[model samples]
Target: MTIAIIGAGVAGLSAASDLKGAGHEVVLFDKGRGAGGRLSTRRASTPAGDLRFDHGAQFFTARDTVFRALVSDLETRSHVAKWTPSRVSLAHTGGTWSAEPLRSDDDWFVGAPSMNSLVKGMAEGHDVRWGERAIALSIRDEGRYVQLDTSGWQGPFDAVILAIPAEQTRELLADTSPVLASEAAASVTAPCWAVMLAFDAPIKTGWDVAEVSNSPLSLVVRNSSKPGRGNDETFVLHATPEWTRANVDKDKEKVAEELSGVFCQMTGAGAPSLAAAHRWLYAKTETPANSPYGWDHAQRIGIVGDWRIAPRIEAAWQSGHALAAILID
Candidate 1:
C-alpha cells in the first residue's frame, strides 16, 4: 500500500514508522525546515559559550500503554533517558517544591541530546520531504480518495493519514469532507510564545525549573539541566497562554523582550547573552477528542494527534500507535 502522511512531528513520524514496518510504502511531508514539529531544539551562542536549548515541549509524560511500550523501546536504544527536574510553583512567594518527571507510568524519559532526536530516530529511513507545505486536497475517481495539492488523480491509495493539528487537516480536506472540517472547527487550540535565552554564568536557582502562574511567564527551565546538554547556561521560558494570546500580534522582538523581562523578574536573573522567541499559533489544544484516535472512510484516511486524546506527547504517541494497530489488524 502507498500512504501519504502529513506533518513529520511525533504523531506523524510514529504513524509513518509503524506503516513502514508493516511493509507499506510511505511518504511523509512537513512544512518545517526539519522534523520534530513542536519537539524543537535550537543552538545558541552565549558569553559563557555555545549552548543547545529546547524551547518547545520541555518534556513529555506517558499515560497510555502504547506510549509506554514505545518509551521502553526508546530507553533500551538510549534514545531517551530519565529527567529529574526540581519543580517549583508560582502560587506562593519564597516557597519552592520538587517532584518526579511526569510519566505515563513510574518511568519517564526524555530524548537523548534533545527532544528533536526522538523525531530523527522515528525518521530513520522513511521518504520524508521537508519544506513541502500541502496547499489543498482533491478527490479523484469519484469518491475513491484525495491527493494533496494536485488533481491528476494518480492514487486510490491504500491510506492517507493526517497527523497534524486538526485545523490544518481540516484546511487541506475542507472541500472534500465537510463533516470532518466541521469536527476540526469544533476542536480549537491555544497559542504560545516560547523564548530561548542563554546566560553568561550559571543560574543560581536551587531548582532546575519553575512553573509560574499569575504572571506573563508560565514555565522556566534550565536547558543545561536536561540529560544530554553540556555545561552551558541555557534557559527555556514559556509565556502564559493569556499572555501569549494578548501579545500574539505584537512584533517578535518586542514580544521576546517582554517575556525575557518577565523571566528575569521571576528568576531574579539579569539580561541573557542571547535570546530568541517562537510563536506557535496553534500550540496547545483547548479541548481534546473523546477517543484515543480517529478513523474515517474505510480506514483509508485516518487522523491522529495529541488533540485526539490529550494535549501531550504521550497522547500523540498513543493516537499514532493505536491507529497503526488498527491499520495492521
Candidate 2:
C-alpha cells in the first residue's frame, strides 16, 4: 500500500518507519526545512565563538517500554545520550529569590550533537519532502490525495496520516472529515517565548537546570551542560505560557530584553553577550484529544500527535506507533 504521512516530526517519522518496514510504500511531507518539529536546535555565531542551543525541547524522558527501546538503540548508534544535570527550583517571594534542589528519578535523554539529531536519524532512508507544506486533503474517485503549496496535489495513496499539530490537522480535515476535524479542534495548545543567551564566560551557578516560579520564566537550562555540547556557555530560557500569551505580539528584540532581564535576576548572572528570542505559537499541549490516535478506517484517513495522548515526546512516538500498528493490521 502507498501511504503518505504529513509532518516529519517524531510521530510522523515513527509511523513512516513502521509502515515502510512492514513493506508498505510510505512517503513523508513536512513544512519545516528539515525534520525535528519541536525537537529543534538553533545555531548562532557570536563574537565569542559559535554556539548552539536546544531551544525547542530541552530533553525527553522515555517512560514507555517501546520508546525506551528506541532510545537505547539510538544511544548505541551514537545519535542519543543520557543527560545528567543538576536540577533546581527557583521561587520568588517578597522580591527575594530562593533556590531548592529539584530531584527526579526519571532518566533524561538528549540528542548527541543536537536535539534534532534524533529525528534526523529516524528520518534516514525515508522519502521526506522538506519545505513542502501540505495545504489541503481531498477524496477522489481514485483515492485520498494531498495538495501541497508548491507541488500541487500528489496522491492516489492508500491512506493519509496527519502527524502535525492539532490546529493544523483541523484545518486540513475540516472538509475531508468533519468528525475528525472537530476532534482536532477540541485539542488545545499553548504558546511559548524562548530566549537563547550566549555568554563569553560560564555563569557561576550550582544547578544546570532550574524551574522558576513567580516569574515570567518557567524553565532555564544551561544548554552547554548537556552531553556532546561544547564548552560555550549557552543558556535557553522558556517563558511561562501565560506570560507568552500576554505578550504574544511584542517585538522579538523587546522580548529578548525582558526575558534576559528575568534570567539575570533569577540566576544572578550578568548580561549575555548575545541574546535572541523565538516565538512558538503552539509550543505545548494543554488539552489532549483523549486518544492515542484518530483513525477513520473507512476513509483511510488518520491523525496522530503528542496532542492525541500526552505532551511528552514519548507520547508522540507511542501515538504514531499505535496508529501504524492499526493500519498495518
Candidate 3:
C-alpha cells in the first residue's frame, strides 16, 4: 500500500517507520525545516557564544511500559539521559519567587544534546520531505491526497495519515472532510510564550526549576542547569496559558519584553540583556479526544497525534503506533 503521512514529528515518523517496515510505501511531509515538531531545540546566537535550549519540551516522563522500553533503548544508545533536577517550589504563592530550601523528587529525562535529538535519531532512515506544509486536502480519482503550499497535491495514496497538530489538521481538511476536521478542531490546545535568555554572568536563582503562579510566569528553569549543557547561565521561561492566550497577538518585541520582565521578577534575576520569545499556538493540550487514534478504513484516512485523552510526547507516540498497528491488522 502507498501511504502519505503528514508531519515529520515523533508521532508521524513513528507511524511511517512501522508502516514502511511492514512493507508499505510511505511518504512523509513536515512543515519544519527538520523533523521533531514541538520536540524541538532552539539555538540562540549570543556574544558569549551559542546557547542551545530545549525550549519546546522541558522534559518528558514515561508512565507506559512500551514508552519506558523505548526510553531505555534510547538511553542505552546514548540518545537520552535521566535528569534529576533539584526541583523547588515558589514557597510563597503571592510574594516574590526567591527559591527556598524546598525540593521535590521527580524523574525527568532529556535528549542527550537536545529534546529534538531523540526524535532525529528515531527518524534516522526515514524519508521526510521537509518544508512541505500541507495546505489543503482532497480526494481525486478516488484516492486520498494533500496539497502542499508550493508543490501542489501529493498523492493518490492507499491512505492519508494526518499526524500534525490537531488545529492544523483541522485547517487542512475542513473543506474536504468537515466531520473529521471539526472533530480535530474540537480538541483544545493552549498557547505558550517561551522566552530564551543568555545571561552575561551566572544566575543566583536558588533552585534550578520552579512551578510558579499568581504571576505571568508559569514555569521557569535554568537551562544551564540541565544535563550535558555547560554552566552557561542560560534560562527558559514559559508564560502561563492564560497570559499567553491574552497576549498571543502582540508583537514579538512586546511579548519578549513583557515575558522577560515577569521571568526576572519571578527568579529575582536581573533583566536579561539578551533574549528572544516564541509563541506556540498549540503549546499544550487542555482537552483531547478519548481515542488514541482515528481511522476511517473505507475512506483510507487516519488521524493520529497527541490530541488524544492523554497529552504528552508518549501519548503522541502511542497514537501513531496505534494507527500503524490498526493498518497492519
Candidate 4:
C-alpha cells in the first residue's frame, strides 16, 4: 500500500515511520522549510554570540511504549537528551506557584542541538518533500486516494493520513468528507505570539524559566540554559492567547517592541541585543475531538495531531501511531 502522510511534524513523521515498518510505501509532505511543524529552532545574531532558540513546541515528554522506543533510538544517536526545567504555573486568580513537573530525573526530553533534529533523524530514509504543499486531498472514482500538490495531482495511493492541525485538515477535506470537516471545523484553536530576544551581556535573571501573570506574556524561557543551545542570554517570550487574538493584525515590529518592553520590565533583562517575533495562528486547539484521531470511513482519509488528543508532543506521536496502525490493519 502507498500511504501519503501530510505535514512532516511529529505526528506525520511517526505515522510515516509506522506505516513503513508495516511494509507500506510512505511519502511525507510538509509546507515548512524543514520538518517538525511546531518543533522549530532558529539561530539569531546577538552581541554575546550566536544563540539558538526553540521558538515552537518547547520540549516533549514520553508516555507511550512506541514513543519511548522511538526516544530511546533518538537518545542513542545523541539527537535528544533529558532536560529539567524549573516550571512556575500562574493561577487564574493571580496566585503563583513553582513546581517540578517539568523537572524530572526520569521523564523529560529535549532535542539535542535543536528539537527539529529529532524529526530530521526520524525522516532519514523516508520520501519526504520539505517545501511541498498539499493543495487538495480526494478519493478517486476507483477506491484509491489522491493528493493534489502545487506542481500537479499525484496519487493512486491506498491510504492517506493528515497529521496537521484540525483546522487545516478540515479546510482540505471538507469537500470529500463533510462529517470530518464539520467535526474539525468545530474544533477552534488558540493563537500565540513568541517574542525572541537576545541580550548583549549576561543579565542576572535568577531563574531559567519564569511564569508570568496578569500581563500579555504567559511564559518566558531562557534559551541559553537549555542543554544543547549556545551560551547566550537569549529568551523566548510567549504571549497569552487573549493578547495574541487582540493584536493578531497589528504590525510585527510594533508587537515586538511592545513585548520587549514588557519583558524587560518583567525580568529586568535590560535592552535586548536582538529581537524577532513569530505568530502561531493555530498554536493549540481550544477543544479536543474526544478521540485520538479523525477518519473518514468512506474516504480513507485520516487526521491526527496533538489537537486530536491532548496538546503535547507525546499526544501527537501517539495519535499518529494509532491512526497509522488502524489504516494499515
Indicate the worst ten consecutive residues by lDDT in candidate 4: 94-103
- Give the C-alpha lDDT of model 4: 0.81
lDDT of 2 by residue, 175-213 (tens): 898888999999999999999999887899899999999
Native-referenced Cα lDDT, model 2:
0.92
For model 1, residues 191-306, the per-residue Cα lDDT tens digits are: 89998887878878777877776678778888889898987788888887898888888887888788888777666788888888889888888887777666777445778898
- Candidate 4, pairs of clashing residues: none
Which candidate would rank higher by TM-score, 2 or 4? 2
lDDT of each candidate versus the true structure: 0.76, 0.92, 0.82, 0.81
Report the C-alpha displacement of residue 201, candidate 4, in angstroms: 1.8
Off by over 4 Å in 1: 47-49, 92-106, 142-156
Q: Candidate 1's error at 90, in angstroms?
A: 2.0
Which parts of model 2 are misplaced by more than 4 Å?
none
* TM-score of every candidate: 0.89, 0.98, 0.93, 0.92
Query: How many clashing pairs per prediction, in order?
Result: 2, 0, 0, 0
Q: In model 2, state the lDDT of residue 312.
A: 87
* Segments in model 4 whose C-alpha atoms lie over 4 Å from true places: 46-49, 89-106, 143-149
* lDDT (C-alpha) at residue 137 in model 1: 55
Per-residue alpha-carbon lDDT of model 3 for 135-187, expressed as tens digits? 87778786888889879987788899999888888887777667678778889
Best by lDDT: 2
